[model samples]
Target: MSKRVASSTDDVASSKKAKIQDDDDDDSAYLEEHKIVVEGGDARPIRDFGAFNEKARHQLEAAFAAPTPTQAISWALALRGSDVISIAKTGSGKTLGFLLPAFHKMEQKTVRGACSPQVLVLAPTRELATQIGVEAAKFAPAFAVRTATVFGGAPKWEQNHQLKILGGRGCVVGTPGRVNDFLDSNKIQFSLLETLVLDEADRMLDMGFEPQIRSIVAKISRPTQTLLYSATWDNKVQKVAATLLRNPVKFVLGDAGTKLVANKDIAQTVEVLDESKKTARAVEFVAAREAAKLIVFVATKRGCDALCRDLRRTTKCDALHGDKDQHERNRVIDKFRKSKKGVLVATDVAARGLDINDVTHVLCYDFPKGTHGVEDYIHRIGRTGRAGNKGRSHVFVTPQDSNLPALVRILQDADQPVPDDLKQLAFTRRSGGRGRGYSRGRGGSSSYGFRGRGSSSYYGSRPTGRFSSSSSSSSSGTKIRF
Candidate 1:
């Protein structure tokens, strides 16, 4: 009788194992069909937005044809009141991914009074804070929600007044520094907060806002739903997530690493040219596509201004950098957004969070510096190819750039052709003939100096098949000498 009982138990266990394998296969197929990956738990993407409230559904249907991968997956998880961590590319409609859930949570809960917001969104930069405010304005009215945006560059009195209006039982979006200041002054309170979001969370941590973020979260004094959206993920982000989140579900849209993967939507081309030839190439490229909206990134404030002057002589051009005041920066961005075609020369400040639609081209006049060069390059190129629109990026490479091996990998991943000269440059540098670095003058002059035996020999003659300047010169009737 004991042996018979053991046989029965084994049969039951086998049945259960078969069922588990079948369920796993179904889940794998579902995720593959939707082209998404989820971790920590099984969270399915929503195919239809019809289940959302009327107001939210109307906005979603009107604004977009359907939900993006991030939105489809994030909406379902966030609505379930689960802590969520989203790792996706920039311009993937992340703002709405968190905002809609936060709005729904607010609607379901009892409304509170002045200075007590139910939802709080922390951004890294003033520009990003303001942009979030703009996005919130579109949906807040439909939800009967009020929004108050506070940032350091704006007037404190105006922000305080806005926060007090409508009982302040709504959404609050601001930078960490300004939000902390308001909390310290007793102008804002988070005791009633239910939803907390960190948009561009990686950037905020990079900017040293961890302490302020912690301080603000500590004020809540209770459990709340938290969401973190970022372009890249690494140990630092993981540490922050571990401390703040509980039983969170993570959604990684693509590869998750310290470096941002190259965006496939943008066709990237790397040109190995002398530093002195960048300005001429930039001007010619813009002239070739006179009506295309372009954003050119430089390394320094001084260099940004100088490049802007050169571009302005031929077409509409503006400069934005840290040196510019808040008002000036806003005006420059607004103008660039409204114009049919123009050029905006800026530094790394505009790389991360600023979203302007219809940008057709991005020129990297000065590649980003430091350890996160690949991440910065991806962000700069992301400015174009937004909202499912196709775009192009042109990068001018010199021997001075230290991230060549990594850059080559980016090209290979995107299936873009690697230039012969770029390969030689990387190999030569790796083999120990270090080239003297190049630097730009304040005036963007062509007086750059370089030292080393192979400084000018590694790069071959400029490729002429597709990237030839012939078309550019013919249209503008101005020849550019390489």
Candidate 2:
């Protein structure tokens, strides 16, 4: 809302460049395990939650099974910088990483300033903000501290009452847009804010909320403690971490369950299909699973609606997207989650914060594109195969995807084999505004990784020939006409 940026202490800004270097940096992608070290700081281990404030201990155990590696590292190195940047796997208990610290810091404050809160937690999506608020609610009662959540798609009156009327205090978890709305109207201020956290920060950047986040942080009265978290260290994330954190500590933990690099438990495969026949292919896959919970990702809200409608005839299916009201979105998600087995078609919005475990399949009905490249592909597939469980992902690719080259490089770097056909698509350039049709594979209908169990190959040896999808999963080869 405010164009002004958060003021930084000159002393802190000057010392930012001379950060302690990580010399013994034995950072490995896989295999050899290493502990976390922050900016030359010694590798730290997770401490016991037993020593936390009496109320804090109760909430910590209630909210999580136990402190995750990221949460532990975050709390372990909490004081290294006024800001800390933690990147860890999704669903690995990232919420408490900042929440615990913020509440703990609040416990020490003796004075309450007018219109200024002690802490601010910013999230990219309402669902995420609401989720944080729920966790905060569960924990704050033990400490007698108040928490408020502000987001769109809800009555602003109640949120306003919580902040303006009752006096926002203890903690506030909210989406950037709604937070900006309040900040712009001068109803809220961060003068007393001691700690600020950006959760799921990469998603905020992808959603283009950088300007709002900057404006919100810049207005903090003093050098506020900041914590930034995300699943990947893409360039945008790195840049923000550099600008916002002062001599910060960085902890990069591979995915939670396996403790190896991310996405190890999930087997991924892709099908290059014609646009007209893509829906048929997707249905075939879902029908094959029968009762498994399936999440089909589409590119547009309209696509989500259309595909969900088509799939409804075969089985009960639902859709989720920004276009749907928050009430409807919640209902759809709850219904799908409770059904034990159902289909949900959605845009990339569901890629993050819509935590529905037990999802057996993540189908990319429409492939990722533009800024939402391989990074997003990872998040979408991440929904399934979580908490040590195994899952499968199927991506549908078409010639229209300019993202093919990047996907090829990503797969190659990860040691996953490049689909033989995808390699050609990645290397070729558009010729005279015309692209080549998908090469026909010889024998089997394209089903990913059906050969055996516990396979990690992403492309599954590429279909030998072009084949159509069939109503039956065991069909030898289903053929389709162009």
Candidate 3:
């Protein structure tokens, strides 16, 4: 529980900045198609795995039909003993990316069943850790590998027993808090650890797990390969990477094939409504879309509860958040996945790690904060438009969230579109007056203006009326409601 405050020494600070720049360059190069391709295809081919250990190669062949881009990069680097920080979009097979390396490293270390975990994979959430464990298990048997997972919301005794039994013979996947607990109890040893993988590194850093992460990393011996992976690499991650990794090879799969840039894959539209009409606007928005499956992400737990209550009363919806029990969370996810046009309200915790496929639309009920929050926003939208399928996303933003302009700028720099009204709003802010709002269609009619919809008095205090929604997908039914 000890905190490791970063010292502001001039040399250290400068060194960190230099590392970030280096990482940016490396990432840019890695994002190009040439660097990502394995054997002449958009996705990495399976033949690349043959270069690794025979058992590892066999497992890769049997389990993965083809190597995902992330997997290909991780496997290539791990085999060469190079450290890596992978930043790729969600559903890009990032789990297998590190798991393959861990398996190979474990096999190389194990002898006569005297295996100790040579690799440790840390994730921000138990669901993500468990997901990695499950994927790892599929390949573990091929090489006689064993794996154990430790996380909160589960019986520690059972995890302890599993750890005791697996004891270095396999890999250990767990959340920072539980893993730190195990390390502190001396139940897990880091002496033989060869590789450390931090999945969803941004989320870990955002949730204030840096102290625990630093503590755990400090315990691990040096000369160990460290892999930091996330959807996006912000300043915080760059700082951690500088402290942990040694000139790590950076791989960034660009926003291509990602629905984010075009705002097309997932419908990127916003509703400007006042506080009083916020609930009603959201309800109407959802009703208009009538998406096959929906995930509504709110900024707070109370927001989630209130939205869910209103949705259920006015429309069909369910809620999921940190306060919900594991059973309920699971049930909600299951229902959301199974039911067509189903809607679920949740916090950022539900943003990443939960793999509910076939989601058609993502609704941002509130503006997200921080780079991780934005990445989580991407992850939420990513829930739909998965596996080459088309999806839509809707973001509800009010005037209070003036930061939206900056976010739009970031997205635009990444080749994503910014709504014309958003641009006008930014202009108006610079001029210190409310610029005229843009309408949806011809001649800039004020019909779609943010006034006198559900509430007129809610203009600056709240948002009213519909915004623009654009589709990048080939689907014909994609539409934005005003």
Q: Candidates' TM-scores? A: 0.84, 0.75, 0.72
Best by lDDT: 1
Tens digits of per-residue lDDT, candidate 3, 12-109, equal 88999999889666644554642352221122223356756676677667755666657767777766777787777776777777877677667665
lDDT tens digits, residue span 1-482, model 2:
33343344554665664442232232221112533435534435454586468777876666556665666677766633346777677766677667776776666554565556677899998877876887788677665567888998887878877786324356788998898888888767877777888998988998899999888877776888888887767789889888988877676665321222436667777666444456566667777778788898887776677667767767778888899898898788778767888788888877886676678888877677666567778788888886547777878776556678777765664466566666656666323333434343655334222222322112112222222333333322232211
lDDT of 3 at 32: 65
For the record, the alpha-carbon RMSD of candidate 3 to the native fold, in angstroms, is 13.0
* Model 1 RMSD vs true structure: 8.1
Q: Which 10-residue window in model 2 sums to the lowest lDDT?
A: 455-464
Model 2: number of backbone collisions? 10
Better of 1 and 2 by TM-score: 1
Which regions in candidate 3 have their CA more than 4 angstroms from the true location? 1-31, 34-65, 108-116, 137-139, 255-267, 285-291, 313-317, 334-341, 369-376, 387-389, 410-417, 432-482
Off by over 4 Å in 1: 1-30, 33-35, 166-168, 436-482
Question: Candidate 3 — worst ten consecutive residues by lDDT sum?
Answer: 469-478
- Model 3, CA-based lDDT: 0.67
| Rank list by lDDT | 1, 2, 3
lDDT of 1 by residue, 1-482 (tens): 69999999999999999998886786577678655678898776665677578877887788778877778788889998899999888878788889987887777756657688888999999888888888897888767788999999778999999889846358999999999999999999877788999999999999899999999988888788999998878888999999999999998876644445777888888876654455666777676778789998887776677667767767778999888998899899989888888888888888875787689889887666578887889899999987767888988777666788788888888787787666766676777756554223355332223633433311112211122222222221112221
